[model samples]
Target: MKRRAHLAGLLALPMFWLIGIYIFSLVMLLVTAFWTTDPFTSKVKPGFTLRNFEQLVANPAYLSTAVRTLVIALAVTVLCMLISVPLGIFMAKIAKPWLRALLAVAITLPLWAGYLVKILAMRVTFTDAGFFNWALAPFGITGPSFSITTVVLTLTYLWLPYMAVPVYTAIRQLPANLFDASADLGAGAWRTIRTIVLPLIKPAIIAGSIFTFSLSLGDYIAAKFVGGSTQMIGSIIASNINLNPPIAAAFAVVPIAFVVIYLLSVQRTGALERM
Candidate 1:
């Protein structure tokens, strides 16, 4: 009984935070999604209606924005994965200690800066007369000038550390003998990575992907600063949040649903356990 009491006391604050704060907020948001607004006064009222959801489904603009956001999220996740795997391998197994430390600092440096600061930095880089254009002008090339491509790149820059750190740690934890054994059997670097490294580190990759993907899905600030006229799911939610809050709430549920679906799909792989 004493041990059980001690465990319960230790768990008290976290359980309260999880249930009282996080879960309560989510429940409120879900409840708000089904609510209605007064047409004349624009005030929220206590009544259930599916009209907001219907609007989301019927509105082509909303549908397109959701699809575009999904694409951008997937693109960022893929880019992070592609870059992280090779970078992690080099940092973990090949780079000298000093170089590895330097690389680690470089990867995490962006996280130290403020979020808006990073977005503005990307904005400056891709502006019409910004560094990107100035540098590429000699080659007769030009910058993308704040398009969906720029949005994807900005998001990747912001979230790369989340993906890279885990992948690098996972790779570092791999038994060194696995590589030696594969080499002894005449397997090349690419072959060894394909057969061994990738399979072992997949959980970490998935764990990292969850962060990048969900963050990209819900981000509006990056798009607002560096996306030119690009619209994302968060853009719609922000626009409607004041003028039509029920619609905003309903739209907000889209990203939540996508994340829940993604978690469900990846749960079988034990990725959530890693997180």
Candidate 2:
């Protein structure tokens, strides 16, 4: 009882800080999404109003930007899963400790570098003299530059580790008996992956996909330097921040609301899984 009381006291301030800082800020945002701002007075009205939200819903530009973001986010999610699943399963299957460690470093080295620098490196490396165009010459797949492909590839590289690490963790956690059981049941390597491996990592895939998708969706610098005039939601929101703070707030609220609902669905699915 005494130790319990001591731990409770230790946790009290952290809990308070989490609520006051993060939760309260989210609540304030939800409030501000409705709180009207007067252009002349520069004062935000306290009462609820949907003018900001309606403006976002009515405008095709904002709607298109959001749709584009979702499309890009989903593409990134698929690519991350495609890469991470095999990489993670391979890491988990590797028996030697030093070899696994080397593989892990190779996987995460890209993430260790700064995001801006990574994108810039990609940008410079994609020019006519850059590796991308040079490598593509034989294939005849040439383009001006910074196409949707560039944005997708840049975002994918940026968030690759985020997906990889989680998936590796999840795969490593799987029981060894599951694989042995599958083999004993006459399942081939492909069948084992299709049935046993993929199902086991569904939670990790979903979690990592969400994280990577959110990161790509919210990335501004990559979209700016490499994806110029692509008009991603991140750039749009950044543009609106100073000029239309409330509208920006509204834009912020939508993604927040989306993630909250998504997280809730994940939680519910997890609970069902537990049951």
Q: Which candidate is the best by lDDT?
A: 1
Query: Per-residue lDDT tens digits of candidate 2, residues 173-196?
Result: 999999999999999989999999
Q: Candidate 2 at 97: error in angstroms?
A: 4.1
**Over 4 Å off, model 1:** 273-275
Clashing pairs in 1: none
Clashes per prediction?
A: 0, 0
Q: Model 2, stretches more than 4 Å misplaced?
A: 1-8, 37-48, 94-97, 271-275
Q: What is candidate 1's local distance difference test score?
A: 0.95
What TM-score does prediction 1 earn?
Answer: 0.97
The sequence of per-residue lDDT tens digits that candidate 1 reaches over residues 1-275 is 99999999999999999999999998898889899988888899978899999999898999999999999999999999999999999999999999999999999998999999999999999999999999999999999999999999999999999999999999999999999999999999999999999999999999999999999999999999999999999999999888789999899888998999999999987767766
lDDT of every predicted structure (CA atoms): 0.95, 0.82
